[model samples]
Target: MKRKRVVCGFGLGLLLLGTGYVSAQSPNIVIIYADDLGYGEVKALNPERCKLETPAIDSLARDGMVFTDGHSSSAVCTPSRYSMLTGRYSWRSKLQKGVLNPWGENLLNPERITMPELVRTKGYLTAAIGKWHLGWDWQKRDGSYVFDEPVRGGPVDHGYDYYFGPDVPDFPPFAWIENDRLTAMPTENSKPDPRGGRGGPLVPGWDPEAMLSTMAGKAADYFDERASDKNPFFLYFGLTSPHTPIVPSKAWQGKSGMGAYCDFVLETDHTVGQVLQALEKSGLDQNTLVFFSSDNGCSSGPSKSIKLAKELGHYTSGKLRGHKGSNFEGGTRVPFIVRWPGVVPAGSVCDQMVCQIDYMATVADVLGIEMPASAGVDSISFLPLLKEPQAAPPRETLILHNYYGEFALRDGPYKLILAPGNGQGFGGGPSDAEAIQRGDPMVQLYNLGDDVAETTNLANIHPERVQLMTEKLVSSVARGRTTPGKPLRNDAEIDLYKKHLHKGK
Candidate 1:
């Protein structure tokens, strides 16, 4: 597959500058976000433990920079999405735990400065295609759910020029939404799903089988349309596959010898390949900055059971500790790959601590734009590390969030968990009560540099370190913003270390 490369013919001029300033030409930005994808799922990231193949995603790592310590702000999809777009911690909002229901109100306030909104300021076209788990303003006709009526507070309302795909995969109203309107009115109720959440008011022919393929084709079409456009475009392609309902298309079924889950993961990789090929075919590859990452860790759903994965000799979390919905490294740590011709170095690996929330600031840094203090309060630009892999990480302290109240704070290599538990929502982990009854420390601590799997607890031995981290977490919460600035007010009262310990005791 030959690709048309674009050269600005200023290589010598750029070399003379000495400073690594980004080119004045606005580059196309494409973000491919996967749902519930584990760090170990990418073969390049987990060469020794990952049995499933992922050539498309691995190719990005080969041609670009791979961050070994990249993470999402939360262990679930909704909050992570919120943090990625708004550059603020989801915990700062009222949604302290769990994801939003499909019919619920939109959590992304319209007033906030979203990633797309910021990009649009530079006159770029923005589009969001695929699963939008974030809530929207649903329409009702005569007190009954109306499908064709425009839904507010969605992609369009949040700054996307175009919006397409299902609102949520396993949630109600399993039908496609083009812009603010549904393609077809959902008239039939879906059968109850025991393993995954059931869909509501689905259209008669809603098939999970064709969902991913259709979305991929639409994304390809989007690239084709924007190929010759005057302004650079930004496409947020959120993939829903390999998350739940574990339905691998016929072409990918049994492709991976592991199981249905592995097969679905392969299909996801294939989808990424298709999108990349589309960009190349449309002559948009060279001027595009491609980013690939997951919303969170691999889900420990029934279809992707831990026992079954272990039996198949596959470790979804690789050498990390927990799965999705936990505060452990495995739950929040994810695969991050970025490629930009003549900008990012090829085959470079960065061990910098970064989070999805930093996307806004990094984008601003790339464009040489300064963000207001009120926006992206928790975001720190990793742009320097991207240009110089040996440069130290911009962010030194990070806070990890879970659906439960168990929060972990990381300062350099040491991490302090406010509570004791696996931080998972399911599949055989100690409950808070169980940990307390077993004489487990009210708090847990570990040095991730020495123990990536979080096997050792150094809280009892290093009370001073634990106390210091606990105080930092408290100060961060009270200040309402992680980055330097005037302390902002949280949307609601936050649950911090002291409160958690008092309740546990």
Candidate 2:
């Protein structure tokens, strides 16, 4: 049955009413988006692992709702973040494959209304801090390493009142940016090496082993000082530790027996703790909602897991087949934990399937804000689950887009992959049509509820379902563009990505 649409969203009120919430105040929201951490990386989600003790994250799940079936909109970084903020599908734009480079041109358009903008309208201060994978316009020309134009169309432009960090690297332009201006200029600065390795082009800066910790500390300070009667703020504190280059700070070095990758994650968890602490310190605990999730599954190269398994006896994506850059379960399904002090139940777990794309609508639903018709076209609000532990949200299908532009639509237990190849390409170019043709990209169907690892193929067993899924996948393509917030046509840049893709890690 279609849920009755109310003129005024009584959703949040009804949700609070379940617990007899009589307060007139709304909870402050904080979304902690982590880069490249997998579901198994969180100890609370994957308890069998002992090396990566995410005490901060474990406490997060212990105090909130741990959603088992949460997913990024795409199986990659840029697109997923785009969808999460815009509440729309990444395919709504044109550049569907891979992600943006550190110095790439601006991806989001000026007219886009972001989550921060939405919440700020209701009197909340907003900021975005961390790894900005979404494209920002930086000055680069004809193979020039130095920059010309200051980067544009980033967090500040997209509704974040204050922004820190870069479109890429920590190193020349390595200095942080407060809003559109530079926080500190990089002059007479040591030419830091490209920070990310394994999966990287290695931009400069990679300096100050204390970068991650400092960001966390400052963010905690920001929350503590700014979150008061004068400023109820929303902070999108994105962390970049576990992404690549495998640089764990000295304190965390060799801390996790699993390897440098796991150690980096420990710091990531610690950073999450700092944000929560900021809330608690400000006495905003009971009136705040904190969300923790990743851009996608771990951005591990195929060899990293094998090496870790041989040396430390560990698998990054747990038992899920395939890893980052592929259209497999491990590439997308990630850890999602939500904690709203006094509102969300502690020690609870939800297995309902939800995508990061739904974030905008859920927040809007929670705050009694309505989304503009053009935004979040693919979003379904899961606000109901926050109030009632067992109350179910609408059963909605989720679509996962791969670098190759091959698509998969997941409905309930059944998933249909619309491609011509094996859908797993190691080249990082994209599991595109050519790769699929070369690899027998046959249509695949799997019941993920029963086969969470996506090991068995049930396509042949259910031909009718395969046909239905194929139709849906085709429709998604027909309706697809690029991310909605992106510019109309950046053929010059999109083509550049397409040309350089074959040379990727």
Candidate 3:
């Protein structure tokens, strides 16, 4: 372990050169992004309340920093994944709402550079395992998933040396890909998820049951193989479990007693343990930067909504007003746990509002690499905050976007929503009723510091503040960029999204 920890010789020399920018002892970066885990889902975050055990995740938080107000760029998978990888807002692209279908053309533009690409330029073997919700072109000719469609715009095209998992569950050719080649060919084209297996159909050649374990095994293997390797690695392990189909392995079944949803979460927690175990076993734990977070809030399921309501008498979105798919605090706010051994303080909690979108520039900054103007437009380097929670975020105003491009920009205590409809979506029960009074207009405003649930609409009283944030959201949309860095391409991909997206359907 001692030999594995390379001493950092921090010098301007690495920074002066265009490539290897991070410290010589640059830690391997691993981002474990859960699909729909909620803000207060982790037991440590809400010890007195949260029902989910997640000891593995709890141990992870104890090892490093835990963020209270972390959010995904988008509430849903595709958009959120797109924003995380590109460091740009999904609204900047054409896919305005919901998510992409498995059969749809890819969402990422082939020409646009990505985070893995940025890091790879500085000598990192970037690999993305597990679920890839961002769209990818697969299987069009002679049973070949590639099909001359030019798998150019995705992680492979960007910077990752390897790729895996379904282009999302329901998407066609539902199988893992190793460097653009499918591990199992879609001998039969998968159909729109018919009845159940969580969300996607139990398609041929695709056993959703084994996916969680399979992915974890592969990740562990990858880490073991890379332990002795010289070049630092950036691995993005995006898990599909705890997302949908709610199917956990038989051993994990009934363990949660909250039904499939909680069972799947337990399975996800085990997967986290597997990852951390691999790092420790390989002597890579100390030098590896491990981050665990979710793309969005918890999904509305029998466990969290019905079963939990019957038993706990409430939902798992915790104190948040709504669940996944809404702009409410639950939808976008998520758990963010980062572990970097000695660099980050253990058991520390940071209340700063940060998003996965900042990772592009933040990782680059930590690595000491110069981000080309073409990359990381919306990404602010949160490198300083990683080691020091008191350090200010690079950006004062952090934005939260719902599934349908409903925008919420937060500047300190004040948060301004661009549109109406309660910002929680048109729904039933208490939340929607409160929204009715506002009539869903005039750019509702609230002091998140005061009203975390956003119960009071201060729009009438805070007109000037509303106007300012509205303008900011509109201007950001107009610019079609998110980060403050330069556009990766002087000529941004005119075709930001692929045709045949779910919208067309």
Q: Go through the candidates in order and give the C-alpha RMSD of each one to the true structure.
A: 3.9, 6.2, 6.0
lDDT of 2 by residue, 357-426 (tens): 8888788777777667656667777876766645664445788877665677897888876654323464
* TM-score, predicted candidate 1 vs. hidden true structure: 0.94
Q: TM-scores of the models, in the given order?
A: 0.94, 0.84, 0.86
For candidate 3, the 10 contiguous residues with the lowest summed lDDT are 496-505
- Candidate 3 per-residue lDDT, tens place, 1-505, comes to 0011122323332232343245457779999998888765678776656777888998988877887788888777888888889887776676766788655667877666788988887688989988776765544466544532445445676678887766564444556666665654345654445323323323365777788888888888888889867668999999886776666888898997767777888898899898889878988887888888898887765244645755774356767766677677777888888888766677777777788998888787777778777666777876666646777665777776665556678788788765544333421123333445635443568888888888888899878887787777656655656555433332233322112221210
Which of 1 and 3 is ahead in TM-score?
A: 1
Worst 10 residues of 2 by lDDT: 1-10
Number of the top-ranking candidate, with lDDT as the measure: 1
lDDT of 1 by residue, 1-505 (tens): 1122221223221231222245667778999999889988889888877888899998898888888889999888899999998999999988887889769888887778898988888788999999888898777789877787788889999989999998777888888999998899899998866536585798888888787889889988998889766578889999987787777889888888777788999999999999999988998898788889998888877436476456876788888887888888888999988898877777777887999899988887766667788888999988777767768679989998876755789999998888766543342256565667677887889999999989888999999999899898889888989999999999988867434433332
Worst-scoring 10-residue span by lDDT in model 1: 1-10
Separately for all candidates shown, the number of backbone clashes (residues 3 or more apart, or on different chains) is 2, 15, 15
* TM-score of candidate 3 to 2 decimals: 0.86
lDDT of 2 at 385: 73
